[model samples]
Target: MKKVINKPEQVVEEMLQGVVAAHPQYVKRIEGFNVLVRANGPTAKVALVSGGGSGHEPSHGGFVGRGMLDGAVAGAVFTSPTPDQVYEAVKAVDGDKGVLLIIKNYTGDVMNFEMAAEMAEADGIKVDKVVINDDVAVENSTWTTGRRGIAGTVLLHKIAGAKAETGADLTEVKRIAEKVIANVRSMGMALSPCIVPAAGKPSFTLAEDEMEIGMGIHGEPGTHRENIRSADEIASHLLEKIFADMPLQQGDEVAVLVNGLGATPLMELYVVNRKVAAVLNAKGIKTAKTFVGNYMTSLEMAGFSITLLKLDAELKALLLAPADTPAFVQF
Candidate 1:
């Protein structure tokens, strides 16, 4: 229950204020909603909007900038944003070129974002949506009907945003996003659970020497829990599962993302990445690019996830494109 805040109920609001205050040049709040839109945007090109619960920072919100999301609607911690909030975000970011919504494959997220899309269509806004389900974990989890979307969503954002920035139409942008979704795979393990402020207790329990493989971001049940193992062993387990599902062949080029689940240190993430790269090399899967850090997180949870995107020329180019945002920037 140790959290820094005036009140549990006000965390989202205060956090939004802080985010807007810190990044005024990049984003602004929607006044009465928990939506954050790129400041002075809705450019002539297609606009991108995405969102979910608030705990995973630098995600749907921090990405609202030049080459990423145009708007983000944040819900309460681990809760889905209302359709009204998402609808407002669509309205704010929709240009004549149309808008795209990048949604994770959570049930609530899909339902809410779809409702918002329908509402926006009623208002004459051309909206298209893509649901990310890149996790190679179990098919159904506590909050989702299919495989949950994990860190791979960030890659989707970058690639899709880059396409949109090129003035691609909504259909084209969505097609690119779908390609990323189809080729990417991810798996995660958790060492510790996180405490939701309002709940005032850890979402789940784990022993000092235990970890759960394929754990969902919201502390949903994983494939199984067992005694913690060495970094190399953990990475092999995760990556092997991903490989079995996606089947990387000899000389296949891929991008790597070793994402922290909030509390894990960069040192540990790099350790995992080392093993990941070694595994890929031994399999003759050439690593095209490597990213290792805390990209997507489950508020204060201790763990990491690895995502591999099997790349083609188009995806590689879009991934390497320039982007300027609060959480991600590349020249």
Candidate 2:
């Protein structure tokens, strides 16, 4: 366990403090709680909150800003935040309008966020939620009940947050989020596993020349493993599976996200995106917008995921809306 840290138990707290120190203009820490809220929060609109384990950097936390999340609760590494912590986030961000919890499709995340929503409702805070299940990896994984939410959740955060920022009510926000979830699909492949500081070991193991297809973010075992191949071949395999599942056709415009799973370099990501774009172009799917970066990650795991969102006019506009977050900025 060669990690630079004071103590494993205090890693999340210290890391968040460092994030606040690094980006004070964008984020602030809630006093005495493992919650990070936008510096200018309680924005008098429908507040958006989402979170999970601490390892997925720039996710629930880096997203707390003007056009994305209002608050994000952090748990221990690769562990869900407690219900009470989530309840605090809801209370801290709720205003005259309401709050919307953007929960991913994981068992622990769903359960804890749901419990917090119930607690918030008890206090007369109008709350709605959208569970993102965009990963088309597998039906039943050990980590989640249904399909796991992966990089596609970033698009959900963007589109839904844009709607909420426009003063959409809880019902409308939830509707828009569901619409995004319905149209988006994602698939990921892992080149290497990540080592959780607390665990002091890699989550999983892979051979030097092997890759895990359809892997989840938590380093869960993927559907299968195979000898590593060229970037083009991997992109083709991923797109084939995603397109087969979603069935996009000619002349359909879509937003594409080629996300690095923490450790993959930008150069490699661009190479992968080249192949993804070629495949989509050949299939007549017009690439309306493309984002290639580490929007969502699994610690320092070496891998990437591709997300495709079939876009309508409404989705296009919302997706293009201005967003000012730590990791993503669109204007």
Candidate 3:
């Protein structure tokens, strides 16, 4: 309930305004719509558009710039953006090379984004879509019919966006995105809960000494909650589950992403990363690149998710390619 804002109902609108206020050079709003597009783009290359709810910041929106998303549609907190909004985004960012939609594997997100894609195609804009289901947590969740997409979606953005930036067509870009979706695996744990502004109450409750393994970003029930463990133990547990799902061999390569769920501190994330790196080294898995920070987040949620992207040469190079965005940048 303690949020800095004018009104709960206006949070998404105001947040978008603030984002543009801070990064006008990178993004601009689609007037009257809760959609953001790259400020100076939609160039003659395959464009990327992805979105879900609004709470997962620096995600679908903060990534609107070169080498990432070309457009992002924002819904209300934890709610899916409507088809009209998504259609607007597709229209705004399509540069004649076609557009690619990177959707998380949530029921609403799948339905809405696909509806938008259909509408865009009706308008003669070529569009392709890929769904990300990288969370090794569960087969189904409150909002999704399959494994929920978590932080690994960001890696999808990076790799596919890089391919698109290379002037790849929609089909090729979508193929790369699907490859990332196939190779990436993620798991998360939460030490505390977060409050949604409109709800004015905690999304879920966790006892002080308990932690949730495989926690979903929207506070959906995870695999189970148990007594809190050390950072190393938690990291190892997450990695174990990931490896179990996608067995990595010694000498394999990967890119690591230690993502914060809004309220988790950088210090804690790094602590988790330390163990992640140690485990991968012990397994002889060469890490190509590592990113540790708040890439995708549930609003004010106190947790972290570890994502490991099994990498081949193509994926490794695309991941390391230059990207300039509000939330992510690499030279």
Q: Put down candidate 3 lDDT per residue, 1-331, tens digits, no spaces.
A: 7788899999999999999999999999999899999999778899999999989998889998999899999999988899999999999998999999989988999999999999999999998899999999885445447898889999999999999999888888988998999899999989888887889998789998999999998878899999999999999999999998999999999999999999989999999999999999999999999999999999889999999999999999999999999999999
Q: What C-alpha lDDT, on a 0 to 100 scale, does residue 130 get in candidate 2?
A: 88
Cα distance off (Å), candidate 3, residue 165: 0.4
Stretches of candidate 3 exceeding 4 Å from the true structure? 140-144
Over 4 Å off, model 2: 140-144
Taken over the whole model, the C-alpha lDDT of each candidate is 0.92, 0.91, 0.92
RMSD of 1: 1.6
The C-alpha local distance difference test score for the whole of candidate 3 amounts to 0.92
The TM-score of candidate 3 is 0.98
For every model shown, the clashing-pair count is 0, 0, 0
Q: Which ten residues in a row have the lowest lDDT in candidate 3?
A: 137-146
Q: List the residue pairs that clash in candidate 2.
A: none
lDDT string for model 2 (1-331, tens) is: 7677899888999999999999899999889889999998888999999999888988879998988899999988888898899999999999869888988888899999999999999999888888999888876445547888889999999999999999988889989999999999999999999999888899789999999999999998888999999999999999888987899889999999999999999999999999999999888899889999998899889999999999999999999999998988988
